[model samples]
Target chain A: MRETPSLIVRYVARRAVPFIQLYALYVLGHGEDGPGGGFQGGVIFASSFVLLALAYGWGQGRKHVPEKLFDLLAPAGCLLYAGIGFVALLVGGAFLQYEAFVGEGADHATKHHAHHFGLIGIELGVMLTVTASMVILFFEMSRPDEEGAFGDGASQEDVEALHDGSAATEEAPDA
Target chain B: MEVLILAILVGLAVAAVRARDLMASVAILGGYSLMMALLWCQMNALDVGFTEAAVGAGISTVLMLAALGRIGRREVGPTRAPLLRLPLLTMQQRLRRARHLSRQHHRSSAWGAILVCVLVGGALLYGTRDIPQVGASDSPANRAGSLAEYYVTKAPEEVGPANMVTSVLGDYRGYDTMGETVVIFTAALCVLMLLRQARVRRGDERDA
Candidate 1:
């Protein structure tokens, strides 16, 4: 079996994923003030995962970030978003009306607090959904079948062994 | 200034369509979309601009690249010579000879291009007719109760979000936004399904 790529590439990608994820969070959090938003930030963050998959291998990438989790999280994020609106409706306000959540507060501070809560909840949901969707898309696109399996253009059997090895590890006894 | 921008947009669009290379065409199309987005921003259609920037500049380019990956990159050479010419042909001659031959070889492609251009141009013209006057304060959007005012003034306070557009999309008109999200999800699901690996049976049918 041939060796993987340089440790430097893996190390760089490993280091970069966190920073990229952090930037995505910043973009999502500050979307109201900046050009970057949930969608763009999500794709940018997902690019790191694609880079990681390229640097390492798909099996390792999938092990690190499972496809099933992404599939679940994508819809879950949207559900959380809609659930917020449902909460607003339950509060006797119109659909998605945050004002009802504010109550009859006298002070401006109280009103601002309520508003922040609602916005944060929604933005977080958007970020989760967008990021998951993008990562899933990358996975779907770059996934190897019979042709073009490894990063170094390796044989299909090697890729299959790698995949099966990862699957076996996933099913292994806990330490 | 508007005319200059429009001219640039038209030129970029022509270049996008006329480019021989698929990747070059896709890149030019992205530029054309971005220019059109800038024009939308200049026109104060911020929502439209946002949608166009995201869908046109981003998603469309990505989709085109994915398509290029599936389809080989090599461009087909142009045909050798022009085939047909009709100076004062009768309807029967036109239908039987010109139209039928065109449908088989080349004429349909040109006709399809012309038809698409005409349809798109007509739609743009029709939409422009109904659009509110540029920078008019009394436009329908402006007069729609306190929505615009809320976006300007109370947006930050109400949503605790500095970006009014984000607040509006994620909170105020969230239902419509949810629908848009669903549309994206559906599209993604469809693409995934269509492209998913198909299982080949052991005793499959005979080869063609």
Candidate 2:
């Protein structure tokens, strides 16, 4: 494949990403009333970045959402989830009891609101983690081997040796 | 509707298996997922349908494409021999064809895989005989005082989400979701360590 796809592909990808992201947000927020939630939303969101990678290059996609951002967002989502659970526990309720986000004396309506908010918060956490992980996987897996330090040791001779089995070793046998 | 989608799914599956080009196989698999998502929608499992569309069809296709970019797309193997021969072949030609057929690799393994698939599919179909049809009120899980009955009846009032799946997943099964989130995060961390460690070692070698 070419390093950069054709102009038509790039133009369409650039135009489509924002709409895809907006729809992902809709899916994430509208889960209670509709057919999507964190996992689906996050995958859709990540796909926008994947589109960018396909049209441009892996380096270009990584430029938009860098590895540094991945390191931050990945853990931040898990922390948010654990923090919500601990908040309920610290207030003398079950670990993830959503009603505990409100005071013990709060009325049913307030507790209902709290529970709704808590579910949204959890979903947000899921979206962040999933989105980061997917982008990370894409960038890592599609990375050009030439740019990697791990490939430095793989010389032409090493490849030939593996294929032809004809290179005689100079080193002595193991002691 | 279900039958149409299922037929398309089976066709896509066979096409994916028979395709020699890895890229075409990935595309066919994506179509299979699309048909599967439609099947889920037909069964009234909208959330599962959404997941199948996004994860199975969309993200997985992109991921496989990325992997394909890393590895060459053409599969390295012996070219398939033609399945037909003229009925009036000479004795020498017949012997040569027989020798060629014997030289083909993986024919036995292919038969073994087909046998395994048939046995497993038959066993699963046989096992489904005991299960009730969808939405049967008297089914084990749907009967009075059962957990599903309790969740369907009381979850909305108690958990405050009109969507029972949301309420159940986010509240009743909060720990499970949390654990899943942690597991995903852990996977990212492991990838980071494995990929980054090599770069860090290279840096140390540079310093030396």
Candidate 3:
């Protein structure tokens, strides 16, 4: 409701986002060795953006992560994922076959090496897609339009209609 | 420990359901997700627990708050229900009004719904008895030569990932993960389209 949250919230959120993002990357990169992976990491990463948005207001948050960048990254991750699969196919193996990334050595070390890198690449792709998608979702959903509940263009009747005609009266004096 | 978490989860569920304020309901739902995440960790599914904590508790709560910002937080209901008016009435009048209000307000249907939910829940609880206990080696899933057995035995050797869960998810079950990613992408795009279209329409109306 307020243009920006209180100073404490803004400061805490600003300070926390970088650490949250770093943790998300740790979860993503450590997926193969630990208990987290792309989805969890990506959500954690997006939560940083969401936290910033809540603290700084949507306009300032949008500036941090622009629409054009979100659009580019959203599809890019999915493409990267699919591209890995296609590359496996091109290497003359089944779809999504990580073993194909390495040539036909059939040795244990080569297979293991290929699978390791392949999983990392795939998780990275997944992380990118998930992160971009979630950030955009928060941005789009929270972006105040002219007809929103507290938007400037909303008439008294429209606001009343949205809030069952009683709640707006309770908060009107504050606004 | 699991029992404690599950109890808290049930309490949170009831609190979320019975909350009069939508904002309170969202907060209660977040608590429920956090409890569920703890339960998942207790069950040794750390990835799922992490996801439940992040997506269920963190992201969804923020999204709901954003949505509440757009639409008012109050649930759409009668501002002045008969129950609230009872303070002015005498004892007998209050009793009569309470009975009348209950019948008028589909109280019987609510009771029926509660009854149905109890029956369905009991059935589900009964059905769980037939399920194999956790990590039961004789179970169909863990039986020798089954796909699970193969994955458990060979995942590290085959995929070179110490975490079998990631190896399975990223490689063996790669298609499913890809589909999930696409679904998320599509869902975001859908929301974007709907919200953008509404904004555009409003802008056009202002221009007109």
Candidate 4:
């Protein structure tokens, strides 16, 4: 990795990252947002994490967005999405029926508000899941210790065995 | 203006193909994507342009470079190409490298596959040329009684979001968006399941 691990680069990254993350949040919240949402914002958010990983190695990188949290958040985003749909179902409407959230005979404005809320909720779910997933994929691929450990168990062991026989015990030897 | 950008894109594409260095090719590919994104923006598709800029120019280039670190960096070149002397010093060494690449991938097969891809892509582009101009108000896509018309007219009152796209995606076509979220979630789960094997094995060892 061609890492420019200097204070100046890190400082610039540190200063710029907050705005990147905030812009990602804006993309996530599309109620009155500018163009681009969910997927774009999620990738942007994930990039911030990836940048930290690259600048400071995955060791410090993993700390910024803990591995365990990423693991949970990835799936949780999808569950949140399904749960919202289930809520709509419980409200006596068809699946994903935001109109049902507004009481029957409610004013048009109320319906509009309900729809807006539902859309924002699901978009948030997308953002969370996408961001977490992208970061996870990045971490998995970028891990210095774990080359060719991406597939099933058998292949991973074969790769490890091959590495052990040929090269130095190079990849995160202690860890 | 569009023609100028397209001409630059064509030049970039040719340069990307001719660039012997894997990393250089990837960089040129990034430049091509930027031009494409610019074209999208010029055509007033800000949302599509934003996505292209973010994904194409941002994470993809970084990821490709990172991947290049794992897989070999400089592509193996043939002996006849004296220009490749930077990496291949001797004829024997270049031939050996050429044989290695041929073993993995036949050069002719690669060219044939690329030709097929270009042919199919051209055909598809030609087929789609007759479709009404993108976002044209009077196009059949936006005519009354169509779903697009319904969303545009009724989305605000019914779905509530001022944006028709969001309303259709999150409210009208809510199930699809939910599924999309689940798919993204599942992607994370799959990565964890596959990549976190060491932790899982440790748990199993303790149980055993």
What are the lDDT figures for the candidates, one per model? 0.67, 0.80, 0.83, 0.74
Each candidate's root-mean-square deviation in Å? 12.4, 9.0, 5.3, 8.6
lDDT per residue for candidate 2 within A59-154, as digits (tens), equals: 777789878888899888888888888988998788989888788899989999989888999999999999998888777767666543212332
Which should have the higher lDDT, number 1 or number 4?
4
Q: In terms of lDDT, which candidate is stronger, 2 or 3? A: 3
Q: Highest lDDT among the candidates is held by which one?
A: 3
Q: Which 10 consecutive positions of candidate 4 chain B have the poorest summed lDDT?
A: B79-88
User: Which lDDT tens digits does candidate 3 get at residues A15-113?
Assistant: 999999999999998998988998999999988988888788777888899888888888888888898999999999888898997878779998888
On residues B22-124, what C-alpha lDDT tens digit does candidate 4 reach at each position? 6778899899889989999999777778889988988788777656655644566552232323363467876776787677777899889999999999999
Contacts from the true interface found in each model, as a fraction, amount to: 0.27, 0.60, 0.80, 0.59
* Residue pairs in candidate 3 whose N, alpha carbon or C atoms collide under 3 angstroms: none
Q: What is the DockQ of each candidate?
A: 0.15, 0.31, 0.52, 0.33
> Which candidate, 1 or 4, has the higher DockQ?
4
- TM-scores, all candidates, are 0.68, 0.83, 0.86, 0.76
Candidate 4: segments with Cα more than 4 A from true spot: A1-4, A31-33, A146-175, B77-129, B135-139, B198-208
Q: Rank the candidates by lDDT, best first.
A: 3, 2, 4, 1
Candidate 3 chain A: worst 10 consecutive residues by lDDT?
A150-159
Candidate 4 lDDT over A1-175, as tens digits, reads 3334899878888787889899888887853445767778898999999888777766777889987888888878888888878998898987777778887998988877887777777777888888998888778765554333222223444455456434422433342
Error of 1 at A154 (Å): 15
CAPRI class of candidate 1? incorrect
